[model samples]
Target: MTGSIQRVALITGASRGLGRSSALKLAENGVDVVLTYKDNADAARTTTTEIKALGRQAVALRLDMADTGSFAAFAAQLKSTLAGTWQRDRFDYLVNNAGTGAQVPFAETTEAQFDQLAAVHLKGTFFLTQALLPLIADGGRIVNTSSGLARFSLPGYAAYAAMKGGIEVLTRYMARELAPRGIRVNTIAPGAIETDFGGGLVRDNAQVNAHIADATALGRVGLPDDVGGAVAALLSDDNQWITGQRIEVSGGMML
Candidate 1:
């Protein structure tokens, strides 16, 4: 953080949606990026290209958050990428934002569904951060994605919210433990947005969109840029003193 070199951020699920938005926002602030995608190579490459268009270095790497076993290899690849692309051995920001959604009632939610949620949202974030700890610079930041569902009641999101709730707690613990190293850890909980998440239920469903808009104080459902800008602000030097907190980017939903 003390050098003239531009800061680098590693953002997961940056192929599209909030992740893609976050990547571009950071790039706009002169931060280089190393982003990941699960299956969409073309979209990931497009995000990298867009970042380059912003005059910042960017790379897209394939990653499966649900597959924890692959993390070691991924970390190795990242280390290599960093040395080769940026001539550095460490990155400054780690954004744990890769995730999927589950929409089943508590009573009907299968064990598999719950496990998948835990694997991607909770376990993956935890272990992936652990794996990359050595490569993250001393005065770095970590932003883990949470959800408004964790704060307000929402049917069909019990499992997903539970994992995010765990992430909120984990953020505090990470902040405390990583304090000696000057590593700040926080969580961002975004409200319903018009994304492809959960089969675009909030984006494509007219009734659902209107319901969320009416419930929100802003009188509109959230958008990718809303959360993206918030993330860029959170990771900015202006908010360096803010850590171990859950900042909800929900447009005052369910309030």
Candidate 2:
């Protein structure tokens, strides 16, 4: 887009945590945002209010990542939203950041838990992007959320990490196929952060937080803004040459 046209971004799971921070950071950088939340309409409204406070247009919509069947409807709604709000039919950036957390050992992990993780993180992301392909602008960018666990060995994360690993691979393939449209696809892997994910183990538990901090090269667990800033940087015009790479925003964790 030209300097005169304000760009728009659609971020999934943006009601709170890293997603919320990413939306806010993009807003600070003068980008409008279309944020989605799974079940918390109030949080989504609050985020949009804050984005609008930053002098950028913002809207909130409900989206359940695990429901593949709803993606078509979601895309239609998104198209209408874009037309109504911006007088356009496409958005410039897409952040596939919606997901749920699970920490179950491989031996004891139930199929139900595994299915939920796969449905939300892997299957949901895959099909949702496919469903939204037409609505994404030709030169747009897509950021897929991965996890540091995919690269590092951790117990009770076999299923979750596996899904993330799949996401990393999918990023490479997406980058390759979508290159014709000048659409860059990359992965962002975040280390332990003090978020509500996984019951906030790293954020609320002093012992766990201290342990993670000790292992991290930066001497502290990640915050939402840590990842948010990296995401904004990755999607910036200056980073056009970079794609299909996994950029870890873990503050040098597990180095």
Off by over 4 Å in 2: none
Q: Please report how far candidate 1 places residue 231 from its true position, in Å.
A: 0.7
Instruction: Count backbone overlaps in model 2.
Output: 0
lDDT at residue 186 of model 1 (Cα atoms) = 94
| Deviation of model 2 at 113, angstroms | 0.6
Give stretches of model 1 more than 4 Å off.
none
Give Cα-based local distance difference scores for all models: 0.95, 0.95
Error of 1 at 113 (Å): 0.8
lDDT for model 1 = 0.95
RMSD to the hidden true structure, all candidates: 0.7, 0.7
Q: lDDT by residue for model 2 over 75-187, one digit each (tens)?
A: 99999999999999999999999999888889999999999999999999999999999999988899999999999978999999999999999999999999999999999
lDDT (Cα, tens digit) per residue for candidate 1, span 104-181: 999999999899999999999999999999999998999999999989988888889999999999999999999999
